[model samples]
Target: MHERQDVRTILNRTTNTVASIRFHLILVAILAFPLISGCQNLKPLPDGLSLQGGEFPSSEVAFIADTSWIDENGQRQVEQALFDDLFRIIDKAQEVIVLDMFLYNDFQGPVPETTRPLAGELTNALIDKKKQQPDMLIVVITDPVNELYGGLQSPYFEQLEQAGIRVVVTDLRKLHDSNAVYSFFWRLLFKPFGNSAANTLPNPIGAGCVSIRSYLELLNFKANHRKVLIADHGSTYVGFVSSANPHDGSSAHRNAAIRFTGEAVADLLQSENAVLELSGHAPVEIDIPRDHVNATTSVQVVTEGKIEDVVLAEINRAAVGDKLDLMMFYLSDREVIAALKQAHERGAKLRLLLDPNKDAFGREKNGIPNRPVAHELTAAGIPIRWCSSMGEQCHSKMLLAQDDTGRNVIVTGSANFTRRNLDDYNLETDVVVRGHHSDSVFVAAHEYFEESWKNTDDRIYSLPYERYEDRSFWRRRLYRFMEWSGISTF
Candidate 1:
């Protein structure tokens, strides 16, 4: 009996040692993976050829001159040529396609031909391509908040997955604003049952393949807010960092996308893969080399958590510069507001287009009145425009800056000039494009700004601000009850 006891103790010790070794191995692996994959080295532009134009150079890189147009009715159309060029590049994708959008939904239009959603058509095209080439790779990454509020669901994503394409939904937690009590209750009640008790709600995408990790990630503080598309391993499209979602509500919003070929696509793919890793998705294969292409035009790749303040700095730079054109769905950042005021004081010509709404995400914050920033700007003698669409909100974040000699700059992306967007609880990206070629693009964008400005009502805040107290007592009570119960997280 004594001998048997000794043998059992030895066996237990060996098992514990093996377990410890395995744990350490996993820890090391996790620590090393990000470091190995995160390094990226961009190459410098070659000599004798500047991003500015001398001749329409034919060497792999091509510059699409930006131009603005004024329609017969004086509607400003800036960057029309740039958008046309971008679409042309998308039309040329020959192989694998990947897209990540924050918001997307199918919308029925007045005409059957125009009824298809932008994402739906794009998905169908990818599906057809997958059928043709069995080995084709396709991917999509989207934000959960946009999916829920924008009326987008997983069936569409699952359909693409069934066709053997990769679809990843980034669980951006900050955007959801999950109530603390609700999350705690879910963790306590549902975690041990391993059943659909509370937190383990039904996966919108169907079946056993539902991602628990995604839902959990959404409860975190950081989020992946990028909206991008890559095709044929070469071409890429990046949506403007704005409130615009791929849904009917945001369809009418004025938005912009930048298209690029050559090495920039690879850079974008790497950035997306980083987000996927953070979301606990399997590591995506990195296809582009560290120093793959010499990017002639200046480009900056911004990420969440870090470098957020840098984005604000750029906005400030533009606002305080000689001339600034700003378009945004929401603008409540105190720093940005102060910067704009200072810029105006500095004799800068500032034009702002603000959405006449409470919040771009359709929520109230800090009991503040949901008035358009245009009112404040216009009162200060700055040209402020209120953009309105037939059925959708104006959802674009773009800034155009110019100096006396047409040295133009353009800043575009998903980052809103708001406290939540700038300080915490959102993911955003913005890029500054410089050089003469970009100047032309800026001019074109300026034209569009002017046209939209003309269409805006000068007195947007003249009407009395609606209050929640106007609702029926029962309705108000129900809303307050939901807020208290933590049901508002849904």
Candidate 2:
């Protein structure tokens, strides 16, 4: 009996040792996967990006916005011109139309009121254009979230595909990992299983159910968050970069865009070709006939990490007597926050209009990074205001800086001021417009901002910073943790 007991003990010890070895093997694989898979060494960025193009006439660049506000009777009203311009550009397309939008689905949960059918409209617009010009090269590039990471079919994407439009879903795996700790396990374990169109679990974003793999992929927190439109119009090419998406849930959100036609469009196309190349799509070669102008304004295409570089350089250059106005949906990038403070300290007048981080479709959210960051900025004597969002968000991402000499610089596009968006983890695109303050684009941008800042025409566009002041110590720490950890979406 003693010998039998000793044999049993030895067998149990061997079993425990095997389990320990297996655990360590997994740990080592997780630690080494990012390097072996080249996940951290992301695909090379497009070469032509961040290059300043030859100056075009200020008339060629237009500032468009979609504004939502409340009246004295507390009624929500929306005035939109951005999409109208976008559709008009689409109608004028004759040869090629390339649209790369982040969110292109109409996925709204149970909501009380009817939202604009932006997804259907955009789909119909593209389909109709395809039917009108059967030979037109219409390409639609979007993210996988619209399809729930292949856990479901996007009706809009199907319609676009049926209409002979080449829809390219961006390969998110080619991008750097935003949530590294979570992504390592996901790549090693879950990613190989691949997502299915089977619906076994309830969808987190909208109605209906989706596979669990969808949720697993969502934990990565990375995306191709670019909203760009390029099409040939008349004799030249036109391009648009905006913060707007054609998703119905975001239809009423305030957004901004810049539309231009010039040498800049070539740079924009080149940058987009890089996306195609990285995503395994054939690169498009379009020979844009550049036209000469009086060099009234300089427009440049800046994407991904280049956006951060340009924005920081502009903010750091803000000296005394310069005025900087920023309207952003998210503001949690530590470097940007510190730069703003330094700019203010150098006597640069700064006015910040930020979304209150309160609404997500029909859901209510606790004000996070925005609220805490606002608290920090207000303490530095920099004035801040909260967009009085009733249910929709103030989703504009723009910065307008004007020097005392009437030189103006406006940077606007799909990027939010968050670590995930600015740090090269997620894909993004933005344009920098350098011109005189009197330029039409600058004037329109200033008027758009002033209308909201001053609450012109009895429209309550924004509330004072005190409306959503977050003074809780714990919440502030939580905000920093989430930002650093990339655990929460900004």
Candidate 3:
């Protein structure tokens, strides 16, 4: 009996040892997953993306701005022209219409009162157009955030689809992982257990609850940040790229956009088609006729990483006695910061009008990124000013460089000069327009900058840098770490 009992005990101990070994092996594989998979190549950049251009008549491109400012009595005032023009462009379309907007939902953050129903208005506009021209091809492409990565249903998307509009939700997995450390495990584990459109967890950005999967997917920290609208208007194709969103929470923000028609529209369509192909949709079949050219300015389409390339090149091209003016929402890209300092050192007079990074959907934010970055730039003697936002962001992303030789270069569109936006993690679109300083487009862009900078009217558009200056060493360290690690939302 004693011998039998000893054998039984040995067998039990052997079973426990095998189980322990299996567990450790599984753990090791999980830990090594990111290092192995994260370095793989991302999807090939779409054709005709980085660089495409032609000399276009200055009349073919027009600059438009939407300004939101506060009066001396603290009344919030808005002069909006961007969206009004967009609606008119949509109304005028006769054949093909393609829109790729990042935020197209009515996700009202804390301050719902401050927001206009931009999403509803935009949705109605598209639906109305589709109803008017049933055979006209209309495609809407957007990010998954609107649906909370399948955790919540988007009424706006549903309404559009019901109107026979094709909506394409971008496949973010096809893009490079911005937050590599978290994305590996998310792809391996969380993604397989897909999500439901029934709310089960509290929503991160707004009122309703979302699924656990939505929160899990949000940690990946990436998006399809492009906001573009292309359409066939009468005899020509018109294209618009802007930083504005059809989102209620962002309706009051100050923004900038440009309307253009020329051979560049063909390149813009091709760049957008790359997004469609990656998202598993067939490209729109439309031929944009190359219109007659009376070359008065050079216009080029630059997307994704190409924006960083063009911006840096333009900055490095600055010489003594040149002027550089930048207006941005976020300015935390390390390379851009370095380039700005170098330009300043080369005697290029630099003026930065930046958001204070203080208000977001009515919530007070500890000024990060912009504040620390502002500190760094100001310490180096570069001039900086804070947009006097009345609970609305100065959300324009534009860079205007004027050379002493009377040549001017204007870079503007959806990119915010941040790592995620410029490093190809998020899709971006910007047009570089080069012309003599006297060109109408250049004149309009300059007037927009000067009026806002100098407060030419009774409205208060921007304030002195000292109004929201931050010199906290710890915050600076924190911003540096976050920007390097790709963990924070810019």
Candidate 4:
């Protein structure tokens, strides 16, 4: 009888304690509801409006394209013009080389391949540069996804480090998480316990699956998407800003870049200082060559939202009889859409080449941002063409505009036309080249857009949007939600 009474007493006390704790938690949540709701109000970072993008020197520019396709003979052929330019710069660097690229890996996953050993080639180029100039400062900056959010080992980065190159992985934790809902739970449950566990699970991104712990960490989904190479060109500084990654899986994608030598070379170094300093590197002493204004083209290296502003300014300046062209991997920015629509309404001829957003590394995508945007544009009477992406992306961010005054402008570099990419969320760079219509880059810009749209030379580059048209109501809602809520992976 005595033992039974004691057991009853203990049970009652335990129940009371749990109830008390639960009541307190509920009260706390109620009291903190406003703060939780206001979590989306993240403080903004320093945007590029105040940043400096220098003037054009007496410099020359190059138009580089890497095209992959099935030829008339049904054989895989790739016309690589970017890598040659990259290696050419690496080979001639006399002082320092600062490279900030988003992806560098051999993780082909389930994507198609080219014969090119892209990752190895880039690693070798950097290593060779270091060997040639033993004291030259060579630094590399990349994203954490390349580490699979702490899953697989990065042999490429390790090789660079071993060769005395400084490699800094951007501290993602320092950046704001755009997905507020996932971020709330992540902060409460996942981040503190160490999301990366033992290496027993399969790496979802590697060619041959490797060890990992969780795929949950990857759901966070932000990246350092800038691709920049700044090195010495003769006695002056040269900059290469592009949409290309050294990832082997992406070797076959149609990509473009701009190489320029001028005062903007120092500006490129200055702009990258934000990334390097954010990643905990020391300050850089940019020994820039004096300005000798290049008459060929007026070049400026713009970063972040400044790219968006410049692109819009150039397009919006179009009068009747002008032309506006765009080719990009993803297109969902509302501002850009509005500008394109306005340009079309104002009688500027518009052509857009966009990815179908359909396939990614063996997995199918629902065509989030692009499809709905495409549908909207098509309804607005804008002509759109979808890239015939074999197993990769139409990973190019370019816009060519010819104003009424005959000023030809092309915006080309690493930025994709997305909210996350251009709105200060990711580090990005692009060179704005303004020249005469006869300039080489200006001419090539128009020709590239035309070739992709027309398929003139008995080659298939793009398909009509009707073939991949997605007009589902729910998908449009989902895309808008993802794009506006900052929960997208673009």
Each prediction's TM-score against the native?
Answer: 0.62, 0.95, 0.94, 0.91
What lDDT, from 0 to 1, does candidate 1 have?
Answer: 0.49
Model 4 scores worst on lDDT over the 10 consecutive residues at 43-52
Q: What's the distance in Å from true for residue 426, model 4?
A: 1.4
Measured by TM-score, the strongest candidate is 2
Find the number of clashing residue pairs for candidate 3: 0
TM-score of 3: 0.94
Q: List, residue by residue over 1-490, the lDDT tens digit for candidate 1.
A: 9999999999999999999999998887566544432211022211211111111111132223232234445443433233344334345555555566665545323322121255565567667777877775666677764344222345667778889988776644213232444344334344344322133444342222233543553343333455566565343333222233454333334565444444444555655665565456764563543334443344444443222455445445553346787877666555677777777887788877665553332333321211434444555777654554223345566766777665666666666665545543445554445545343445556666666656333322112113211324454354445433334321
lDDT of 4 by residue, 195-235 (tens): 44345666777743433334665666667788999997777
Model 4 residue 218 CA deviation (Å) reads 2.1
lDDT of each: 0.49, 0.88, 0.87, 0.80
**Judged by lDDT against the true structure, how good is candidate 2?**
0.88
- Candidate 4: which pairs clash? 57-293, 57-294, 58-292, 58-293, 58-294, 59-294
Order of the predicted models by TM-score, top scorer first: 2, 3, 4, 1
Please provide, for model 3 over 1-490, each residue's C-alpha lDDT reduced to its tens digit, 9 standing for 90 to 100.
Answer: 9999999999999999999999998987677775644553355654544544554553578899998778878888988898899999999998999999998888876767455789999999999999999998999999999988888888989999999999999888777777877787787778889888666888888778988889999998988888899999788899898889999889999899888888888878988898898888999978887666887786788888889998999899998999999999999999999999999999999999999999998888888889999999999999999988877898999999999889999999999898888887888889888889998888999998987787746788889999999989999999998898888988
- lDDT score of residue 405 within candidate 4: 71
Residue 271 of model 3, lDDT score: 86
Error of 3 at 202 (Å): 1.9
State how far residue 483 of model 2 sits from its true place (Å). Answer: 1.4
Tell me the spans in candidate 3 whose CA falls farther than 4 Å from its real position: 1-19, 34-36, 41-58, 113-115
